[model samples]
Target chain A: MENEPIIEVRQVNKSFGKNHVLRDFSMDVNQGENLVILGKSGSGKSVLIKCIIRLIDADSGSIKVLGNEINGLDQEPLDDLRSKIGFLFQSNALYDSMTVRQNLEFPLRIHWTKEERLKNGYSAVMEALTDVGLAHTIDMMPSELSGGMRKRIALARALILRPKVILYDEPTTGLDPVTGREISELMVSVQKKYNATSVIISHDMNCIRITSNRVIMLIEGRNYADDTFENLKKSNDPKIKEFFT
Target chain B: MNPLSTYIKESPFLKEIGEIALFTKRFFKEIAKPKQEYAEFLNQCFWIGYKSLILVGVTGFIMGLVLTIQSRPTLVEFGAESMLPSMVSVSLIREIAPVITALICAGKIGSGIGAELGSMRVTEQIDAMEVSGTNPFKYLVVTRVMAATLMLPVLSSLANAISLYGGYLGANIRGNVSWNLYWFQVFNVLNYGDVLPSLIKTFFFGFAIGIIGCYKGYYSQKGTEGVGRSATTAVIVASLLVFIIDLIAVQITDLLGLT
Candidate 1:
């Protein structure tokens, strides 16, 4: 169980109309590894993770997450599988209408019953908020928060379920450098806290340097290179070198 | 291909109709399945019903008053002044109030649903709900559509009663028509025939408005511009649907000899 890949993609292909976004892309993420998927904008980084969750079905090939082939799993099983995966969107998709508490509780409302919530909901919310250093923002709406704070709250909500596999889509794309670093550090702490595996999609060098154990360079819709962050930084292959330079 | 067949093949309109039909079928299937959102449904009812009541009532009153006043001059000219209350009651119950209320809801409730859901879709909140392992369609679409479907009739009924009172006040505007006489005329001329057909049509009107609004918002593309477009199209399409459904209802009532 420990040696088996936590998330596996075997020759996955996806396209939008004539735009072939992913051309026979394949990857394997081992247990507790922080795998940063580095790619330019519109390079199918987001599509790959969405496919792993079956949010968008792959055009062809296999994706197994936590040992379940997810391509055509029934709704009941798909839902059960989803409870173990936490996704942090690039936009920090906190419900704008809901307060921070409600935003955090939205997942619980769906996945847990009344009794389970009554017992542990408050503490869980408090713990998550505390982890993100936003305990004071429980009653605040997302619009009231700054971009960094919203991202933190989204991270808190994603971690509230204590998911085993966390996917981050361009986690620090829009933040100032200091705030982005803070998010990167928080992400690392969370990985330690849960011993969770992460597949982060980001082009931020500082974030990748801080968080990635292994880096996968996605170039032209394929995993062009997979190596340690240090090795990738030293890569001479022009496609991989262009990213570092 | 002939023009008609060519139009059918190439027209986005036909394609949209097919898409809407599929979306409507999905709503039915999603509603019948497990995982209904009762709390959210109640919340949507508060928004669609309680929020829209006062506006509907005021419009009804104004419509009734104006109809009575305008008809009074024509009746007085014909020396048929006593027929005011009976005519106003029949006209309001049979057609005007329902159509007016539905058109008003098309502007208010339909646009509201479109903008709300459109913003949600553009923001990825709907996708977030899906990622959270919840059916966004079941929560967002079904609850709002169901609320709109149920709320329109209740609002229309309230509007009808208010409009009758407004007619009474309007009847007294130019010349004195006693309260008792007005009631006598209203109830005496009114049969199940006048009320039933209009009430039945209001349900159809409500369904059309809600479904159109939801459909526009659910499939909204682009971003903020798309949201604005969806809201506008919701109002336009729903208003058109209200008229179409009303015409069909009237034809049905006429065929049944209910008119």
Candidate 2:
């Protein structure tokens, strides 16, 4: 599917009352491309991602994922569509009341076959944990895990579905520099291994430089820059420079 | 009324009305969605129902005993001591047991679910579900609602049985009502008309608690503070809904001449 775009967000506009978060924002990701979105806080980075996933409805424009127009789909098909994409939130978003195993198993149990769930599930969970270097802590609760471990568990959860696309919303925001770099590298490695389209939302220059092949910046509720990191840095716009600096 | 107080009162009242309307719309939208989360349903039943048996059982026994003791002397003053068994059974099965059990559940299960889902919302776990192609509402709302609906009736049934036993213990503490005679009086007055409608009402009570809790928690904004608010509001609203629904059930039953 190299000739086809995996996710296309076209001219999307989102407004929460008078505050317009995304104004005619547009972007695209081809199959297996790792696209990182760079924007300061409140630059509509998250909202832009949310609109693509239909988590937050766009007031106007279109979002087509896997060749399906997601905007008009009902809940059943919407859920079907959602099952194809994996999302990692900034907080890691693990279910605190459940064990780490349960957290990893939740989505699988919800969507997969019982046999597939019980038989393949354990190995999948272990594989995902090992992939993230957290194989020893399967039974531990989320509250018991450190920040980096939590992010890893979240990554494992995203991998459970073997999704076509993975969306990371500030995946390494709160980690220490070393941990954050490690996470960025893991993200790159995972995307490469799965050959999955990855859209990462971050303002961190290091994360962008390390993981992204292409960077898109959202400024003043629209696409301000969409190019390689090198080209983005060379853009003469002071606002874009300020964002990079 | 003072201008400030008047505005405060009106603003909140209007806000509440708006919230109720929004709640109604969302509830309808959710119901209209066809895909059901059966796994979540079973999981919640296991969590909210099976796990809560001990708490409800203990509370039910104590409530029965206390209510029996409290009501006995009044009946005795009127020389209606023999009426104790029938009186206690009717009250426990028809109103007290179900209502009390629900309030207990609202506090226990409702707040627990609210806080759980609220924190999920605060932490963007719900958003994660959205992106991963899971209907968070199906996984969260349907399961919790179904659990509450099915479990509340079971809990109330169990509570009613224990409460009657508690009443029996209370009666035997003083005078001479045989176990056979006490049960004879209880079964004599209690019928499907009395029990079924009451049982039916508990399902609605359970549903109200589950839906309100999930709704409050799912839509919670403002992070940790939102979670606390969702939990507190869920319990309060669910308890109030229990009484309101109970009142409506009672009226409907009376209108149908079931009582």
Candidate 3:
């Protein structure tokens, strides 16, 4: 809950061949801070997250996570570095071949404890599911769950690893307002409980309102505005105003 | 130029070459790195190995039966009807069953892994994996390749046995070869060389299919349509690689006087 930033991006750039998706984008995520990123479709919001995780290599600029430079690190250390961050995909990205329990157990099995020490892990999964209000559907397949439930399961999976930072990509995009609000509330509550840093990518105003104490608007791969929700609402920039309108 | 050779020459060789190059590149990248996602790998193996048994089994049996039946008349004409079981077993062990099984796997398991991974790629699950500190390639490619390499040989072995059974059925339908005599002749002609080399080659075929399919799918570009295209292309490319690898294996083994 201190003002120490856990994630820092300095002028990162990425492009697919000729098409530039992210250009000179920089942002900071403080420890225990819930920072919601608002951007229109294809504005490179997801790319920013991708750059942070090193999924897609950045074309230029340096990214530091917990004061460690991530861009040039070898695969082993990068993977070790990756174990500390949790990602909740927009589609939930649950392995359709696995049941919910299997899905939650997957990351833990790989990155955490072995099978013998799996009780704390199981309880953590159940705890995450309960936090997201999905404690009853432990054995269900991803295909069998509703969209909201799937997202919850994905959140549980992400949290099961007990990561320091959780990056949620379009968490509430596909859900109904009620479900979406519930998700936003869950994110906020989870952030408070874990005292973990959160970076959410969404255009949903409700998500921004509920989850973000700090909002950063990305317009055309650069920060359009960086402020609290109220200030973003009152900003005189036409594009920013138009976005709210 | 003759029609068949000309057609082969005129086929999309460059596209195939590009695909092969891409596949090789992706495989090296996957192996040259770390970030092993064991959970995802085991899951893939379960899908690619455990679920594919029935299809490979059925095809293996049919291939044996059909080849035996078709070859019986030719053998009978040469007064070599007694060689039917041996001939069928050799054919199944050396070529038909392994290749056919691989083709089937390319169609079933290969394309499935391809499409699933391709779709995951397009939808940003792969990206999510990376940002979350997971290596998509290790999690996606190595597990799948390892699964295919391990499972395909087992499937091929099973296919060979079933195919011999099919040959027995086909031989008994009209021929005079008894069960004991048929198997005895087959065993008499069979050597460790014929069986082992062919079996050894099948592991490569499995590896090729797994790698190529995974490569095509993992690097799949575009969106939903791209995923579908990647799946189809993965099967086609992996099947073609199986043939190429088989040809190379034959030449190498021949040069070494093993086959």
Candidate 4:
């Protein structure tokens, strides 16, 4: 990975009325690295990821993604910026009324031209599904799939655009251990294949261990700790040790 | 006393009204943008218009039949049984048909849109669309509102036609009024003023139903309970707005000397 940062969050703060969530948080995500954010439930991990994608505006701060200031862009330019960033929602957010193929085709329909889609849409969809090992389920509705399969389909949809940055919010939260590990493994392989930078929000230790090049602990709405999984595990601070134990 | 209850009752109403006004403004702004969502708009037209025909048709037929039958005795007492078709046709076309059709749509299409979009919101599908660089509001809201505005007028027209036919059948039930004479009487009493104002009002009714439905759904929170609340609230608000719009339309028509 290069020394240049792909994402820079500076002194970000957010609050929902009286309940402050993010308290002047700051972090940097370098290019071509898998950075996992670990936090307890309701620790603002999801909010942090949302801020990075401009899905949720920070109360105060500056966030730069791919060298563009997120807060300053207009709707059209923001949309264009978003096309280069993929997000895997915790719920998968697959359109239940549509088939997996249609769900996968949705992003391309928005961002790609008719000629471009006609030339490469099917092949692109096939490649994404193949990467997630769910090519057979293309015509199936999301309701027909198991949780793990749905996660895989969501991952495939995220990858279809060949995005430079993928934001994964709890990619393996609801799956069993084996399936979770499988998803984690796929995350690593997909990272290598696409050379895509990833910021994963997760509390699953196994997921963090398997997928993260570095881990950041979000505690009290700040970057409480930053280190590798092994080093973080060896830390003696009570809050850091709480996660490892 | 309960200060919280007072705040809950008073604040949410004012707050919701303000929010709905803002939502409506945003919808207008988004709709004015280029590259309308045509495919989704057509799909919504099919769902909201074509699928709603049977219910509106049946209700209108019954309304016309009942009105004719109920008025028959009074007309008989006045020795004006011949006036039955004119009276029923005027009532149906001038007011009953549009109101009934809009109410039915409020119950059916409004609730359906609210629940569908509410569930999508809760499940994060809307957010997912936004994150994927798609304009979910344009794709979801504008098309639905436009479809409802255009389709309700057409549905009302169809319902008015069916109701006249129903009035004909009711006229034949107790007397030997020929179809030709019945329709002739009906047409003689009708004019452009009677039809035009009623038709114009229905477009507003349709717009209200669609906008309220979308507003409820698009901003829903608190998960599944919120979805149910959105559907129920959409129907109630749209149904109420239909009457309010009808009342205003009546006053306008009266002032314009169309009534």
Return the clash pairs for model 3, or none: A53-B131, A82-B133
Write model 3 residue lDDT over A121-219, tens digit each, in one string. 778778878878888999998888999888888988888767888989999988999999999999998888888899999999998999998999998
Give residue A243's error in model 3 in angstroms: 1.0
Q: What is the TM-score of chain B alone in each candidate?
A: 0.97, 0.91, 0.88, 0.95
Worst 10 residues of 4 chain B by lDDT: B1-10
lDDT tens readout by residue for model 2, A1-245: 78478988889999999998998888888889889998889889988877778888899998999999989898778878888888888888887878988888888865788899878999989988888899898999988988998999999999887888999999889999999999999999999888899999998888888999899888889888899988998888898899766
lDDT of 4 by residue, B107-214 (tens): 999999999999999999999999999999999999999999999999999999999999998888888899799989999999999999999999999999999999
lDDT of 1 by residue, A188-214 (tens): 999999889999999999999999999
lDDT of 1 by residue, B86-161 (tens): 9999999888999999999999999999998898888888888988898989989999889988998899998899
**lDDT of candidates 1 onward, in order:** 0.93, 0.87, 0.84, 0.94
lDDT of 1 at A76: 81
lDDT for A167 in candidate 2 is 90
Looking at model 4, the pairs that clash are none
**Residue pairs in collision within model 1:** none
Task: Name the candidate, 1 or 2, with the larger DockQ value.
Answer: 1
The CAPRI-style docking tier of model 4 reads high
> Which sequence of candidate numbers ranks them by DockQ, best first?
4, 1, 2, 3
CAPRI level of candidate 1: high
Q: How far is candidate 1 from the true structure (C-alpha RMSD, Å)?
A: 1.2
Query: 2 or 3: which has the higher lDDT?
Result: 2
Tell me which residue pairs clash in candidate 2: A82-B132, A82-B133, A83-B133
lDDT of 4 by residue, A68-173 (tens): 9998789999999898898999999999999999999999988999999999999999999999999999999999999999999999999999999999999999
> Against the correct fold, how does model 4 do in TM-score?
0.97
**Candidate 2's error at B141, in angstroms?**
1.2
